[model samples]
Target: MYNPVRRNRNIGTENQGFGQNNRLQISTPYGTLKSFYERIEKYQKEVRIINDHEFLFIEEETRENCHHTCTFDDLESIIKQIPKEDYGDLKFIILRQPKRKEEILSPV
Candidate 1:
């Protein structure tokens, strides 16, 4: 007997796995926006959440241009804010920083 209802339930489980793969590795300790804001503020650095998988940290802000960068310490700070149990399926965290204007303007 082929049960359509049973098949649908199995399909739902498969979909759940897909969603899990797309979530951020870091889980907020307080589970609130206010907590996230406060924790980030302690760094005294500007951050931009690019997506569930990535974030950008701005290191230098200037009148003409801004420098976005990340360091080992930055990653450590972020990891410290998350609970160990919340890491779920996250193998790595990628950080991207834009090149400085001077670097772009200057030749190799």
Candidate 2:
């Protein structure tokens, strides 16, 4: 499970809104996490810009959270480190909410 408190970092998205702490958590294997990165680094042979600062990446995690509208360039380096294997319990998504682009981009 993704325990930010255990990892000692408030990284990633918050499944809950302000004043709420309903973030979903999942248990991930240490070997899976390590190999995931190893494969990424080896397969990362290209780079593409998403926004001004971010780039595209094959981000994987235990929870299926919202995918940021824009990608960052910095993630390219990080993606390369992941291994090309199933991340066990981790829910892997190449992009964030990939199927909801139109809905996400539409004006309310």
Candidate 3:
């Protein structure tokens, strides 16, 4: 797993939110692109950018919460994945399907 640089300036432990301690506690967002690609290369997933409009990647079924939308990760992550300075016009090609059940001819 790739751990991003953690700055202690404004972080709170235990997933705290606003108004509880008068501030929000969140993980530091945006790591270096080198760290980002290191993660990708470690997983050996393929990626491609099309016409500066679409970004595509293949990921394995590893995390319980991960899906095709890639929302658990944020736009800070989106740039590393999409590599776009301006991401408003980017279109997506999501291709993920539930695994098909295997046939059981015999229960033995």
Estimated TM-score per prediction?
Answer: 0.25, 0.18, 0.20
Clashes of 1: 0
- Residue 82 in model 3: shift from native, Å? 17
Tens digits of lDDT, candidate 1, 1-108: 987667545455656555555643334565577532233221334444322434434333223453335564667678667865676445544333323443454423
Clashing pairs in 1: none
Q: Is candidate 1 or candidate 2 better by TM-score?
A: 1
Whole-model Cα lDDT of every candidate shown, in order: 0.46, 0.40, 0.43
Q: After superposition, how far is residue 41 of candidate 1 from its true place, in Å?
A: 32
- Model 2 clash number: 24
Compose the digit string of candidate 2's lDDT tens values, residues 2-103: 865686243465633444664443334665745322333212223353222333346432225544554445455454455535233333335422223334
For candidate 1, which ten residues in a row score worst on lDDT?
35-44
lDDT, residue 41, model 3: 25
Q: Residue-wise lDDT of candidate 3 within 10-88, one digit each (tens)?
A: 4676554535665432223476544212333213244454445545554545446655556323432556565455566
CA lDDT of 76 in candidate 2?
51
